[model samples]
Target: MTVALTTPMLLAAGPAHALLPNRSCGTVTSADSTAAANLNKVLTGKLRGSMTAYRLSCARAIADATRARGLPNQAAVIAITTAIVESVLENNPNKIDQTSVGLFQQLDHWGSYEQRLDPAWSTNAFLNEMVTLYPNNSWQNQQIGVVCQRVQRSAYPSRYQPEVADAQRIFNALTAPAPASKVHLEIVGADGGMWNTDGDYAAGEWSGSWASLGGTGLKALASAVTGNTMHVYAVGSTGRVFTKDANYSTGQWSTDWAEVPGNIQGATALTASVTGNKVHLEVIGADGAMWNTDGDYAAGEWSGSWASLGGTGLKALASAVTGNTMHVYAVGSTGRVFTKDANYSTGQWSTDWAEVPGNIQGATALTASVTGNKVHLEVIGADGAMWNTDGDYAAGEWTGSWASLGGTGLKALASAVTGNTMHVYAVGSTGRVYTKDANYSTGQWSTDWAEIPGNGAGATALTASTTP
Candidate 1:
C-alpha cells in the first residue's frame, strides 16, 4: 500500500470517568493507591505512579484538544502536568475542593458537572483558557511547572513542581513511536485470485486468513492508502483496468469491481500514487506505451480519459509522489530502469524518460519509495540478489552506484516508507517472506534479512503500503 497523507491512525479508548479515591486535607497524594492498582491490573504488571493505562487516553485527549485549538506540545505538557498534580492522572468526578472535578480538577466555573467529567471536553476547556492566558506558544520557553501554575492559578502554586518528572515520563511514553496500524500486503495468486491482508501485519498475523476477492483475471495489483480507505487497481487478463475500494474504517469492500476506462495490453503492470485527494493510476499499456488516468475519490468521480504517457519497452512499473512531483519508474525491455517526471502543479510531464545511472538491465522486479526529496529504488537482480539505487529528485540525478542488498531466490518485492525508515518486503523462490529495514536518517540498511514465519508460495505479485 502506498501511503497518502491523512489523519493519524491510532486505536483510542474512551475516557474512564470514575472518580479517584479521595485524599484527606485536599492535599493531592503522590500516587493514588486504588488508581495505581487498577492500572497495574490492566497492564498485568506493577508500574506504580506511571498511570500507564490512562497515559495514552489522557495524552490523546490533550493532543486532540491542542490540535483543534492550534496549540503546541508545550501547552499539552502544561495541561498534563497540571492534571498529574491535581488528580494523579485520574478522572476524579468527585470534587476535591469546592466542585472541582476531572483530570484538570476544574471547578464549576470551568463548566457543568458532566462537562468537567468528560476528559476530552475538559481538556479542550483547559487548553482554551491556557492559550488565552499564554498566547503564541509563549508558555513553551517557561518552566513546565510554572506554566501549569499560571494556567491553574492553584492555591498552592508550588505543588505542581514535584509532579514535573512524572509528567515528563508520561509525555515521553505517549509520544514514543506507535506500532504501525496499516501494514498492508496485497498479492495476486497464481489462480488469478486477489488476496489481501487486512492492514494488520504488525500484529504478526495477516488477519487470521487472507481474503480472496474472487477475481480470475488479475495480472498485477497495486493499492494506495488515503485516509481510512484503500484503493486497489488490478489489470484484467483482457488488458482492462479494474478497481475496488476497501474502507478500513468500516471493514467493508465495494461489493463489485468498477471498470476503469483504459486500454491496456499484454501482461500489464499497475502502480498508483496519491496527491492530495487525487489518485493517479499508471499502467503498461498493450501497445507497450505508458498510460495514465486520475480520479478524485473525495468528489466520487474520475477525471478524464486515459492519456498516453508516450513511452515504449516498459515492463515493470512503480511510482511515488513527493509533494507536488510524481515520479514514475519502469524497467525497460533491455532491463535498465527509466523514469518519467510529472509536475502536478505545472500539469506537465517530462517529454522523455531519463535512464537511471545503474546496471539494472536484467532485473526481474523492482519497487520504489520517496522520502523527502530522495527516491529509493530496489530491484531483484538477474543473479537473484537484491540491488538498490538512490535518486536525488531535487538535483535531477542519481546519487550513488548500485549497492547490493544481498539475497537469493527473491521472487517479488514491495516497499513502504514511515518517517525516515524504509521497510522493504520480498518473497523468496521457496515461498518465504523476508524484510529488510533501512533508516534514511542514518544512511544504512539492515545487514541481514529477517524471514516472516508463514510461507508465501506461488505469489505472482506483491505490493505494500502504510496507513496514515
Candidate 2:
C-alpha cells in the first residue's frame, strides 16, 4: 500500500496538489489584486498602520483559502480575525512555542510542520476541526470570539474578540459588491480615439453620452467588467497591447494607459472575456496564431505573457464565458467556423479547434451572445449577410443549423444579453449602427434592424460587457 514517490514521481505529481487550493477561490484561479487594493485603502483610511505587502498577502491567502472551502463571508471574517490576533495576520516567519506556526499559529497537533506553515492548509485544518465540533454549521450562530476560541483553544480568547471589528471591516471592504452591472461598449470612433458608452442593458437604455478615452494609433479593442472596474484593451497599430481601467464606483480611471506585457505583433483581431477573477484576453497575433494572456485586473498585472493557442490562418475572433468555461470562436482559413474551450475550473482546454457541425462554413467574423447557458453565435456569412447558430453550454450541443437574420453588408458585430433578451449591435456597410433583439422566452428576433440615433461611423471594432 506504500509506494515510494521518487524525485521524478513526486516532481510530476506535486503540481496537481499544489494547484487545487490555488484555483478554487470562488471558481477563480484566485488572484489577490482586490485584496491587496482593499488592504491599501483600509490601511490608509482608519486602520492606519504600516502593513507590509507580505503581511497583506498572508491575509489574502486566508481569504482565498476560505473561498476555496466554499465557506460564507462570516467564516472568512472569523478566520481572518483569528489570524489578525494570533500571528498578526501572517504565517509566523519564525516558529513560536517550539511547535506553533502559520497564520493561525496552529500547534503541532494540527498537522506536520509543513502543513502548519501553509496558510491554506492550516486554515482548512482549523475549519475541519471547527466543523467537527460545531456540526450543521452551528458555528454560524456562535459569536466570532467563541468560534475563534473553540478552534484555537487560545489562552487569551478575549484578544480575538477585540479584533473582530477590524476583521469585519476588512472583509466587508474586500468583498464589497461589484459596480452596478451594466454593459460598457468601448469602440474605435471614426477619429480613431477610444469612445465608450454605458447602458443599463437590462433596461434597454443608454445611461450617458459616449466619452473619449483618448488614444491614438489604436487598431482593435476588447473590454470586460470585473469587480467594480471596466478594463478596456487595444492594440496599437505598431502591435503593442495597452490597457486601462475605469473604476466606475470610484469614478476614475487609471492615470494612464498602461501597456499590457507581451508582443502580439500583427494582431488582426482582439477579444476579451471575464472568467472568474481573471480576464482572458487573446489576439490573432503575427503568423496567424492566437496569442493569449490573462489580466489580474485588481492586481493590475498581466500574466502568461503570450501563450499561443496555435490555430493557423485564423481570421476574426470572439469569446464568451459561462460559469468557468470559456468558449473561443474563430474563422478558419477555409472560411469554416471553428471553436475551442478553456475550463477555468479544471485548467484544461479542448484538444483542438473542432469544426462546429452546422456546416456553416464560409464565415468571416463572429460574436457570441451568451444568455444563461446558451450562446447565440452571430456571424457574417460568405455573402456578407448575417447568420446565426446556437450552442448550449450545459448540454454541450449546438443547434443543428444556422439561420439567416436577413441582413447584408453587416461589417461589425457585438452583442450583450440583459435579462432574457439578446441585443445585437452591428455596423452596416453604410457605416451606421443598428440594433436588433432576440427574446429568449419567445424565441423571436426583432422585426428589423432599427438604426440607433447616431451618425457615429467608421468603427473597426466593438465589444460590450455585461454581468458575468
lDDT of 2 by residue, 410-458 (tens): 8878888776788888877876667788999999989899865445677
Candidate 2 residue-wise lDDT at 85: 81
Question: In order, what lDDT does every prediction score?
Answer: 0.76, 0.77
Which 10-residue window in model 1 sums to the lowest lDDT? Answer: 23-32
**lDDT, candidate 1, 185-247, per-residue tens:** 777776787877644544544554566776776888888877778888888888788888888
TM-score, predicted candidate 1 vs. hidden true structure: 0.63
Model 1 pairs in collision: 1-464, 1-465, 265-286, 335-361
TM-scores, all candidates, are 0.63, 0.63
Model 2 residue 86 distance off true place after TM-score fit, in angstroms: 33
Model 2 lDDT at residue 109: 82
**How does candidate 2 fare on TM-score?**
0.63
Give per-residue lDDT, candidate 1, residue 336: 84
